[model samples]
Target: MAFVLTSILGNDEAIKILSYKWIWSEEFLNKIPLYLLDDLLRHYNRSTMEEHKLLEILAIIKKDFQKSSENERFRD
Candidate 1:
């Protein structure tokens, strides 16, 4: 899974996979390590393409992570 996430940017099919809502779900996102997510964010930010879906996916992923962390903090 991490391999797919990390290499997705290199290929069209993989990049297309990012459009699916399941890819941004908490369960799938939680499966990915923070380091990898950070790396993905960096790559997404560095992208030269104008207003790509990857950016949108990144935003959704970040929002989900922020909400998840806030919920955890509230629980604590």
Candidate 2:
């Protein structure tokens, strides 16, 4: 849809986007174990799967938030 949207360059759209949290949601916010964030960080220190690492490293934090809209959380 790049052709459908206006160009963000030199426009106020970029600023508007940066100021907002498009990725934030009830599910993602709740799933992120804030209390164990430190422990989670430890996982990145060791060697791990390349694809998973690529997604975690290259993907923006907001992009992950956006992805949550499509992917669902596990239910008990």
Candidate 3:
């Protein structure tokens, strides 16, 4: 999940969505690995050309996370 998020962050749309104050809160940010965060900072520091494609990927990830969260809630 962290890898996917970091990879998607390279896209401008993903960056814009993820950079929101609520979305980029410390709790969510802390879940990412340090190395992934460093790589994202160094490599994905700027937006990429494939913004639409990457945003699609981000949407898929978001859907998966929501499903997983729902499943977890049901289990609890």
Query: How well does candidate 1 score on lDDT at residue 42?
Result: 61
Query: What does the lDDT read for residue 29 in candidate 3?
Result: 54
Q: Clashing pairs in model 2?
A: none
Question: On a 0 to 100 scale, what is the lDDT of residue 69 in model 1?
Answer: 33
Compose the digit string of candidate 2's lDDT tens values, residues 1-76.
1111123233454333333343245654454445334433555346332444334432444455354442243323
User: After superposition, which runs of candidate 3 have C-alpha atoms over 4 Å from their true positions?
Assistant: 1-16, 19-21, 45-76
- Using TM-score as the measure, name the better of candidate 1 and candidate 3: 3
On a 0 to 1 TM-score scale, where does candidate 2 land against the true structure? 0.23
After superposition on all C-alphas, the RMSD of every candidate to the true structure, in Å, is 12.7, 12.5, 9.3
lDDT of 3 by residue, 1-76 (tens): 3444656455654554444443445665565456544554555545532445445545644654554432232221
Q: Which ten residues in a row have the lowest lDDT in candidate 3?
A: 67-76
Regions of candidate 2 where Cα sits further than 4 Å from its true position = 1-22, 37-76
lDDT of 3: 0.48
lDDT of each: 0.51, 0.38, 0.48
What's the residue-level lDDT of 45 in candidate 3? 46
Model 2: ten consecutive residues of lowest lDDT: 1-10
- In candidate 3, the residue pairs with backbone N, CA or C atoms under 3 Å apart (3 or more residues apart, or in different chains) clash, namely none
Expressed as tens digits, the lDDT of each residue in 1-76 for candidate 1 is 3343455555664544444555656886775567655655566555632345445545655565444532232221
